[model samples]
Target: MSELYDDFKSIVLNKTPLIDVRAPVEFKKGAFLNSVNLPIMNDEERHEVGICYKNRGNAKAIELGHSLVSGYIKEQRIQAWSDFIDANPDALLYCFRGGQRSKISQEWLAERGKEIVRLKGGYKAFRSYLLRELEESTLHFKPIILGGRTGSGKTIELKKMSNAIDLEGLANHRGSSFGQKITPQTSQINFENNLTYELIQKLHDGFEHLVLEDEGRHIGNVFMPESFISLMAEAPLVILETPIEHRIEITLNEYVIEAQKMYECAGFENVLEAWQESIQSAMNRIKRRLGNQKHSEVCNIFEDAVQEQKKNGSYDKYRDWVEYLLREYYDPMYDYQIQKRSEKIVFRGNASEVHEYIKSVTLFSGRLK
Candidate 1:
């Protein structure tokens, strides 16, 4: 027999590796940082059980679940659990609630001479807690938003600030049409969990100022908390400026070499082919904004650039389209948006100058390294 624990603080703060007994589909929807799913019932069986519970009642659901997952299937599940416990002795197990599924796993584990602890309120309770924690954290964060035109390397400057939170990085996105990562993005709940965790940690460390890059309400599919957005709107801003040539170099590195490294690391096959497909997809997403003729021209040039790379390893062919997109599309869009935000600007300079200004400012000074 294992103890049923309901200590949310310990469960969260310790971050013990979890043997999540939830069905694969449930796990995929949302999960914590250190979970290895070892479900007693697979997705289909879980679905059937859920339907039974809804229509036939809890007792009937239990009977149906037992019938569905018995004999060889039951033994296989217990064996898998045993294998994981053998490898991770400190691991805890939980399902939606510390109910039948988790309890049964515990009984089976005990039969195999292994002890397991279960979360009393399971994932639901903790997830509820996490949401509350996130909302409450907004009060403590004194956001200092980093505002700049595209390719000004706000992410670069953000890293230099000691109290910064990279929400884009947390979302595993670059926060733009072209910000796709080779690695799959985290589920919405998972993204929120990690983001909240980072914020709480910073607050606990006693950093009052939170620096963030200026972003829209949404980054890819991950939306910023409404509270955070309200905070950002009122935060002091530092706008970065760089020469056109410098912007071109920065954007080129991001879209090409740096992006390629991440793509390859994520196990993308035929990396060049992947890059071409991704580039085309990104361009298509912004087609309405780019307008028909300009969109067509950009796509044509992108295709030519891809062909050039495939031919003699010449990605220099991208320079024309990149420059055109910057001058005509991104620069104009940024200028229009920035014009509306004139009152928010507290400082404007290149990265080094901005860095110096941040160092000199009392609000951003003492904590920075």
Candidate 2:
């Protein structure tokens, strides 16, 4: 009998490679950050086998699975697994419940003179362990939320701190409709699991405090776990204050100039055109909030910027709408919200002062190096 491995901590800590032998559909729902889906059966085969199991029982289902996966199909899968094992020798293989699929995968690998360990309770057990850790990990750190208006450099300053977790980075979003990127955002499970890994690593490195952005429950479509969001809600907030002009510049660069560059880099046929459509869609999302009049003004300004960019390749024209939306739409909303949480404001300052204050607090507490 082969060893049944279940040291999930060591796996996560070591960044262990994982071979998920569950079908693609299962892997798509959720799996470890480090795990690759090299399934024993494809979705169709799994579906057929599932029906067989439901009707004919485990023995017949197992036989059907073998029959379906045999011949060149079996050879091809075994070779893929072998190649992965060669590259990631420390990798562990697993199925949904560490059951027949993983056992069969292991047996095949062994037949080819290759030995690989499979997880004891598999994906289900590992996922449960991670969720438990995610909830419990909140208790191990002191959280500080960095809050600011639309373009007040909250993410900019947050990244400077050694102890900060870039929630936006993890979610691949900037917490706005315009924040959607060229790449797809992570699935909710992937987001939580990635966060759990980050938290565990930080704790391992002896950091006792975590700094995060002042975001609502959802960032784009991904959201924080209830326990995690509860902690963030109660945590003290430090606001990063920047001059209005500077904030406009940051917003212009991030949403307009940088966004265009990203589209160009991704080889869009018409970079500005694609970016313009995206911005228009974002504006439409907040049409009700901006009201018809302000929304029309902002849209006109954006159209002017697009035309100006097309004419001279200058992004300076973007500032008008960017500033308009920041001052008119986002600023007042932020002000109202911040006023309600005035009691939680611990330190408010310019970026430099805010960074220094956090550094000092972290150092003084001796919780983080």
Candidate 3:
């Protein structure tokens, strides 16, 4: 009767103001875009009412709840509603499930002759709509995966592209232990929601190419949705190549200075122990590959390289050690993955050249074909 469908869709598109009628804790956990929490029941009251419903019955709980909220409190709520109306005359309100709470709130507002719209199915309906839209949108826009070994600057190149979706950026992680960021990572659910939102924005914008960094299923604590992952594997790819020196420079620029400072500030004794434990098996393989004397030398070299990185302002010395690790560990794994992938190696050059080449290609062609 209130043009609920049209109003809800407009709000979903962020064309209308959203007012959430759930408690603060529920809102903190998650909420729809642009929605602000304005609770009808305070935390303690909600808990008490819920407990009464469980112990006594619904009728008694309702009676007790009404008794707890005095006439003065109701007047205060009306005043709050007046304030909200003054601020947002055409606001849309929703509760958890479009149940008694939202209906009551809507009726109360309407009694004051205020124009307000109630979400038909409330938060649950909004969540279901987002999930369905995400699923449907993935089928329409294909992704172009960017693959390379660690430190290849694939992520940086992806950012340079006019049309790109950064899963790692959305997750607030760089896809590895070494990929830590300044800000705390989002909850996995939030990450998925953000990714879905980004996908929708990109698809609706009518971008011909959607360039994304090559990532495994998980980026630290957050895992990409299976729909996006399957879409990634099925899409074409553009692989960039850079020399070991260039790769090491990029990796060191990203990780070493920050990691060193973090280690110094936090004390790396624990980190050193953890690092030793995590890479012990891999180090053993490296040790066996080289004879005892050379293995000893390699260990000294590795330690010296780390020490040098700590002392020198530059990261050039660490290149050899990182390259050795990549050759021994990361390269073989990447090679195996590349063999299985149906990717096109578009450009193979140093970091600068590769960036330039990608720019030219995308600018001239107007897409990554």
The C-alpha lDDT values of all candidates are: 0.83, 0.90, 0.69
Q: Which one is best on lDDT?
A: 2
Model 3 clash pairs are none
Question: Which regions of candidate 3 fall more than 4 Å away from where they truly are?
Answer: 1-21, 33-45, 62-92, 101-118, 180-184, 258-328, 342-369
How well does each candidate superpose onto the true structure, as a TM-score? 0.89, 0.95, 0.68
Cα lDDT tens digits, model 1, 116-231, are: 89888788877887788889988876677788878888998788777788888888889878888877787789888877777766776677777788988988888888888888
Ranking by lDDT: 2, 1, 3
Model 3 lDDT tens row, 259-325: 5555556655665444434334445565654557756655665677656645774556666666766
Q: Clashes per prediction?
A: 0, 0, 0
Residue pairs in candidate 2 whose N, alpha carbon or C atoms collide under 3 angstroms = none
> Between the candidate structures 1 and 2, which one is better when assessed by lDDT?
2
- Please provide, for model 2 over 249-339, each residue's C-alpha lDDT reduced to its tens digit, 9 standing for 90 to 100: 9999899888888999999998878888898999999999989999999999989988898899888888998899998899888899999
Candidate 2 — what's its lDDT?
0.90
**Superior by TM-score: candidate 2 or candidate 3:** 2
**Worst 10-residue lDDT window, candidate 2:** 360-369
